[model samples]
Target: MQEQKRPQFKVFNTPELLETILLHLDNRTLLVSAQRVCQTWTVLVQTSPAIQEALFFQSQEHKWHAESISSPIYNPLLVQAFRPFFPSVHEYPPIHNNTNENATEFQAEAEHHGRDEDSHFSFKALDMLSSPQKKTAYMRKEASWRKMLLRQPPVYGGVTIFKMHHNMGGDSCRSYEVQEETPQANQENKESDDDHKMLKMGHFFTAFIHNEDLYFGRFGHTRIYWSTYVPPYESDLDGRAGGSYPPQGGSYSRKVIENFAREIVRSEVVAFSREVTQCCVGGKTNLTQEESLRKEILEAESDDRV
Candidate 1:
């Protein structure tokens, strides 16, 4: 006896099918394959905000994005650049008299946070910068001086009055005073006052805020300078200008920075392709080997940490 033919399953609607495919496409290859299936699939993959956001978040979570990695890790740089400013508590003796009172106050303020003696005075600086309501009582005690210094520029005339002061424990801090320049004295005079004035105009502060800690630094010289890395502008691409490259014109603009980053990414992609080709030529046949190579490529493309 002839058995009844099994009923054929109906194909899902296009959107439903696309969604199902997307759900299963955790791997980049499979995702690309789904995109190539049809015009509808391609458009859905390309234009869906939810899908893009999810992909981006997942890639970042997996450390797959290059720009994310290349962003300069600022903490080390901050420590290096500012550490020399503070006096070391171990090598030198503490100041005496009324000045000793200020030192004690500074020490107490620093210790109240429970930070180790060797920690940079950045915490103190940050404390000073903090809001009135948030500042510790000790910080509030010295609020007037902090506020005055914060309001004033560190450098004036032909000298930088803010000399680096090291505490007894080797922590660094800045102390402000007039530094008179004597023409006859032995000092490094790399640039004239006129040159410095020109450079000041080119200088900008780049501030980076990470995990509630704020780092600000001056970059550039007479030809060009960058302001501290502030929070990304509304128009900023990839945010923080971390992946951005200096433009040819020696100026920082959104378009130029974006283009610079794109070019770097493009170059990285080209290099990655060459490496893959070389690996294949070397007779590497394992899929895992290939995947490892690809992962390395993606990492190399990620942000350049200074």
Candidate 2:
């Protein structure tokens, strides 16, 4: 036991090795908790460009990096930013836009190989979007939500909950509830703490390819007035020099792929959309109420048919 004391471990001496380790660290730990560990670590993490890039690339904006790290995730803006680090494809995959009839054709091929080739081909939007943000988790969350929504389809009340993005990189995406015109009777009696707690953070976008499905973003959000190209002299002109790009409550697609996704998700997005205001994503009461109401209504309607 005394002789074992002679075997002292060599201390990690280089900042580069530390940088790589820090880069690999969980984002929250690195930002909120890790830096506070020690002065040397704080300086190293704060000053390291690689760490900064890693953090930036992990933002909800880079839904692809989180959701689809294996195959090429198709966001031009993010691709440009990360082009230097990207593996150069010896030959660019042929543009499948329009030339292919099925927008989801790539999915069939992915499915054949199954998880053997790609674990994330199924594209778990919410799984990739968890608070701590893990890079490679398979997600059926969206599919499960779809089943829940479609099982008892809601009346076309319009988008109750909308998650919309800041164009390019304007601001974080946000959700707005339709704010129910019918106020609850016990509104005043309800404790303030009982009110739905709004989680302020989420991912929203016009279009992204996840598994076989075309998702607007990893999360849901509605359209905003942000657009670079404002089509003027159109019949439905937004009544300004630069009108709302998708038009308010209009088509959310901007790019070719977005247009395709609009077609795919339109019915699904619309059926679930309602007109409730200030509703928060995953708000306890709000979420429970919506799910319960939809479940009841759908079941009742099915009974009526029976």
Alpha carbon lDDT of each predicted model:
0.29, 0.31
* Model 2 per-residue lDDT tens digits across residues 1-306: 655454231123368777777777765577657788888888877677666544442223244445653332322222232221111211123222432223133233323434212211121222333332232121223311121111111112223233333333332222332322223654565543232111111112111111112122323322221011112123233232122223223222344223323422332222111122333445343334323433443343344445
lDDT of 2: 0.31
How far out, in Å, is residue 241 in model 1? 36
lDDT of 1 at 160: 20
RMSD of each: 26.6, 18.0
- Per-model TM-score on C-alpha atoms: 0.20, 0.27
TM-score of 1: 0.20
Winning model by lDDT: 2
Model 2 bad stretches (over 4 Å):
1-13, 26-29, 57-288, 291-306
For candidate 2, the per-residue lDDT at 291 reads: 36
